[model samples]
Target chain A: MHLAEGVLPVEWAAVWFAPAAATTVIGVRKLRSKTTQIPQRKALTGIMGASVFAISLMPIPVPVAGSVSHPCGTPLAAIVLGPFVSVVVAAVSLLFQALFFAHGGLSTWGANIVSEGVAGSLVGAGVFLGSRRLGLSLFASGFLAGFIGDLSVYAVTALELSLGLFGVSELGRQWVSLFGAFLPVQGPLALGRRCSPVGS
Target chain B: MSLRRIATVLVFVAVVAAAVTPTALHRGKGAGDYVGIDESIMEARAQEAGREARPPFINTDQGDLLLFVFTVGGLLAGGALGYLGRMVFVEGATSRERTRSMVDGR
Candidate 1:
């Protein structure tokens, strides 16, 4: 549920920009840290980016929401590509979605990126690595990575909305209520995670 | 498979789940019930020079229900993926793998 420019208050949107920029910088630093080979890194980043873009548009029917939106595909990106690279991929894909599809607004792209990019990198990759260490299966690790990555995206999306440009609330209550929309869809998704850890 | 990856996943799950509760619960109210752009408003905005003409999501009863289903599915799927991804992708130590192999052998 990407917010458009006219819907939100300008001031709050402005408030979120700085944090979004910082998030992006963190992603960039992450990308820099992993370049054992620059060319491969770029290629991987490109692959990850395109994959995320395609996945984000995968159009899972929102149960009863009556509209289809794609999975952020953050989990797969993070697990396969690593966090830093996933962030960049998510960021670029989101940029494209905003510009071409009008899926989200340009002014809010940074905030959107933070939720989709940084959160996915951190959560998806984090879980996969951690779970595997604890002796979870590879598929399970991938599933966890993706599931968490997506959740992080949703959470970030909520927090970003909570910034409350329309005088919604200082406490972010306005943003908290949107979780209801995903209920019917999340259960099967979780169970399915047991089978497919990776986004595949 | 590493300690770092596990921690990263958990932290991501915890933070997003904890922080974005409000957002997930209360999304798209403005656009949910939209009948479509107010033609008059769109016209007025068009005259105003630089306004974007975009359609809003109509939060019909069917749509709302779908959104709700999606959210629930998302949570379950995300959580399940988290638990299962860890389980499958991370191979266990000797005992755990041995136990499974032994069970399968029996």
Candidate 2:
């Protein structure tokens, strides 16, 4: 889901910016309130942030695709910390990845955040909560959340890429192929919870 | 050490070896082998669409620098995760028990 530097056009980048920024602001407010209520949670939040940074950036090779791909870490973060707070964690990690690692570019950071942060977190949290409501055990619910949430990041990325690269006209034709490219590697990784008990 | 601790360490080592060994051995062979899907697939598609990925501002792709950064980052994150585990499972559980006992005594 790393949209490298200059991948998205300026217009598309701007299009992604508004919602990403707004969501991040909401995440910040929510996190502040949470931390304020329980000061000890600060440590856990830091741990989650670090985990997101490491997990999302670590590329594992999948023999099926003969290529490596990163796992989105937002799902597990969302399950443990609230979805909004997970968004903040993802945004911060993505920013660091953009600046230091060059995995994603500054220009396309907003789009990356939207996919990996917003969509991943919401879907993960929703799936986990819904599964629990349906009487699924914690492990079962976590597995579903991680698997679906990981795939959702790439799904959203494909949409962004289609819209940004081909405009609105070719979106219907492009996203499927784009998303398909990710499946070979991501499918198995997501099944393994991206090599952790909880992760995308 | 306890059996669980030994097992955890062994598992961690095995996972690291499994992830790193093949890629390290096959270095400089072919572009496709172990290349990130981001570059092999997504970026390729973007290029076909006439939008190219420019060089990053601080290109960590320079000769094992990316690997070095990942190693350092992994270590720091692992440390934090260890602390998190203790906080949530060890200290937090103990604290809850203490609170329960206090309430029962009252």
The most accurate candidate by lDDT is 2
After superposition, which runs of candidate 2 have C-alpha atoms over 4 Å from their true positions? A194-196, B1-32
Candidate 1 residue runs with Cα over 4 Å from true position: A36-38, A62-65, A165-172, A186-200, B1-106
Q: Using TM-score as the measure, which candidate wins?
A: 2
lDDT of 2 by residue, B1-106 (tens): 9775575467446644543454455444435578897888778888998988998998987889988877887888899889887887799889999999999995
Write one digit per residue (lDDT tens) for candidate 1, span A1-200: 34554434466557767766776677788777776554345545555565566556445543322233446776677776676667677777666566544455666666666777777678877888998898776765776676666666666665554454314444355445433333323323433432453362
Per-residue lDDT of A1-200 in model 2, one digit per residue for the tens? Answer: 89999989999998998889999999999999998998767878888898899889988776645678899889999998899999999999999899888799999999999999999999999999997897666766786788789889999999999999998988888998787666666776776664575555
Q: TM-score for model 1?
A: 0.60
Best by DockQ: 2
Q: Estimate the TM-score of every prediction.
A: 0.60, 0.86
RMSD of model 1 against the true structure: 12.2
